[model samples]
Target: MSETYYLHLNVSRFELSLNGSLGQSVNITNGSDPNAANIYPDISYSLLTVLLLIMIATVAGNGIVLIAFCASRRLKTPFNYYICNLALADFLVGIIAMPGFIVYNLFNEVWPAGTALCTIWMYFDWHMTFESAINLAAVSLDRYWSVRWPVSYKRHTSVKRTILILLATWLYMHIAFFPGYLYDRIVNVYGEHDCFWDLVMNRRFCTAVAVLGYYIPLSVMVFCNWSIGSMVVKRTNATAQDPDVAKKYAEGETRLTLAKDKARRQRQPLITLAMITVCAVICWAPWVIYFTIAPHYPTALPDILITVGYWMCYLNSTINPYLYIATSDDFRGAIRDLFCRRSGQTLSGAFSMIISAAPKRTSLETSVRRAS
Candidate 1:
């Protein structure tokens, strides 16, 4: 007997038949409404507008951070190196991930791109996301070292070393995410062209990815920030009790004044770290938790919850640069100076004002330069 397959498509349903002799059939109903798979037209239009705005803001905000870092030589310290890289990762997310995501959402969760494009899209999606997470952890560790060790932090963390660490983080992320890519390329059996992850089917791999990309880095960041906070409190108390420290600074009139100034400087970096940690948790934790648990109860999770999780994670990229601007006078001043020069303002005057107001170089930087 000859074997044959038949495909059937109708306005309200889809069907497939294998082996005309054996008569195996599968039917999928398209439901009573033609627009069932699509979001409500008005809602779709509104969401499209909102997502477009988010995409634009993500790109513009991260672009400004990259530009500000590049334009200001003073911002080129080892710590800001991590910030620069984080900005770059977020910039890539804005450019590579956001637009496709917008299309995906607009199309009602359908993947318009073919398999090859889908694979590439998924790779970049994880790559940029993991890069941002690891970069945030790196920033937390850098701040911790600076606050805890101060003098030796500079000597140990040189520009070359920082570059090496950044490269390693990027490399590690690629390696960590390689298994998912490999699975998609080799083991994916789904004939339907879709860009979304099938978390229910790929439970083990997704769990591994979540642990490596989210939980591990989040733990590290929390630990480092906690240690840094403790150190800051101890240091502030010690400085408050030491009158000689005020005499040494020359700018401080009393121990209380010196302690307050030191606390202020220390608080800035901690605030920056805290914001990064909090945002990461707020944006990523829900997604991770949902994905990890949703695999076990696939039918119980709603489609809208998945969409919310994804967009919340995407919002992280949009919000990071603003955090830098809010917590960092240096970053703010750098952006201002960059804009001023771009708009044909006198650089000398702007630079002089910024330099006057800027804090002195950290002990880490001073030591790094001396060693160099």
Candidate 2:
């Protein structure tokens, strides 16, 4: 996955790695020509364990997001619907993609799962990862639009509109980039026991995949975040100059400290989406670079780096919900409702419990109070 078609969805057979601990490298015929394909043998059990944990986290975290959206009416906004779409993608990656990949990597000798299932795994693995980036872009773009034209955005936005956007995104990703996967399927015939893909033909298609999945989405998110951030700063400054408040502040020495704090706060935007973009760059950029340039350059990046590059995307999925909770009131309230409602811990319930615990006034005390 790392050295070749990104995720190496091209897994045919894993032979002895660089150290050559196994008996010998296995050679397979790519149609007329036979070539030696090396399966990375040093499968770090600790890393695999961590990946398993990430997969679990991805599933649980995204699942919580989905449930939170469903459980609370407060979160039923158009933007939240976009977030829920991303969560659904991350959830699918966890439940369907990660486990399949982890298991595939675990059995380094031969793919126990039938080749047909292997093909399906390959398809889903790329599709889910691509969907995540695309969805993030979509969500960021939606936020930018909402902020840029708040009144119009609110007037036009609806759950139905969000659903349509999501549907379009899903369809576009599937239909536009499908030929790449289909090409791999057609060019690299699967082994009876292995799912190794011959990447010679994939070189042409890898760039397109990288562009659609990584570069374009990355650009979109960055542009959207930048636009929103600029607007936030301008709006904050404009509102802070309110004539009455400015006059009051100008007359007071104590207001100097408050102004400093307010200025610091104003320097930052409310949307922490920039952080998400940073995380995406950290997690996905290496793989994107490799997929785009590796075929032509053939530079051997460290196994650790490659491992981090691919799995870190899963790590992003794991942390996405918590990050949203930090920045989004909707997510926070929805999650609070999800947990509190299930545990019977609503605010009204707390108040009732407090009232019930108070000592009752006796009749004598009541009569004395009345007389007083």
Candidate 3:
């Protein structure tokens, strides 16, 4: 049986372990706690099963998205590159971050890994998670502009520009986040069990990075979606009342039908982006609210915030690939083709086939599905 130390677990962006009992400061030094006598029995390995299942699902879903992106030329759209990057971030979280985190919680929140690994996980967890949110925001903004200005978008949109934008996001996020994080991890030395997260000490700096990484991006997603939504509504109203457009469609005008089809295509990507925004808001809002409010009432908040709320954020990562891919026929077809190729049920020669079979896209990548 594991030792019951009656400590409330505090899982945040940086910190992911049990601290002292509420209102009681747990000593982080070499010595054991003076008051380890409370017998709270709820801290158990019961969560391991749930957590592990989620971790597996998270990995498998994102893995398929990555594999599909690589294998299918259909998914080579411009903004979809951003989706690919988001999948990479989420995949890292599922593969690299979640396993160690599960081990941390499994062993009563005392980290099972070395201090070095713990510090790395601490950074990877926040950075990748934040990176995903920002990527979605960037895609939403890009899609909005493309929808708003279809004529100019054709001239400007390209795979190279998409790659450049993704690079810029990675650079900007690292610059905004890593320097301060590196400073804290280097300066504040702690014990084997202690993964030092000086969020309380570095509140302003942490909160600013959080804003830059998450909250601002969140606002941008909302604004972009709203703008796109309003434009689509106006266009729909204008088209519905126009007798000329209706008559052309009725009279089998090939050009008019093609134009209408193109317009329908433009609206589809926004729908996908909007769906992602809804999922992000639902999954992230709890963790975001909890983290912002928890520091103030560290002693008073419920234990479930760390367990349930944090998992909700991770759920955001798990849900992203499926949500985005499921909506797009290209992604769906790509994923279907991928599984069919692997339908032989053999790992033998699979890697070679994947490597050798990957095709390069030579055409200019347009804006999202409906953008062209």
Candidate 3 lDDT score at position 82? 87
Write candidate 1's Cα lDDT for 261-311 as tens digits: 776866886798798888988899668868777878887767678778888
lDDT of 3 by residue, 170-197 (tens): 8878876887788778776665566546
Poorest 10 consecutive residues by lDDT, candidate 3: 7-16
Candidate with more favorable, higher lDDT: 1 or 2 = 1
The C-alpha lDDT values of all candidates are 0.79, 0.74, 0.78
Model 3: per-residue Cα lDDT at residue 329? 70
- Count steric clashes of candidate 3: 2
List the candidate numbers ranked by lDDT, top first.
Answer: 1, 3, 2
Screening candidate 3 with a backbone cut-off below 3 angstroms (N, C-alpha, C), the clashing residue pairs are 265-370, 266-370
Question: What C-alpha lDDT does candidate 3 achieve relative to the native structure?
Answer: 0.78
Off by over 4 Å in 1: 1-43, 243-263, 345-372
How many angstroms is residue 371 displaced in model 2 relative to the true structure, after the best TM-score fit? 41
Q: What is the Å distance of residue 270 in model 2 from its true position?
A: 5.0
TM-score of 1: 0.78
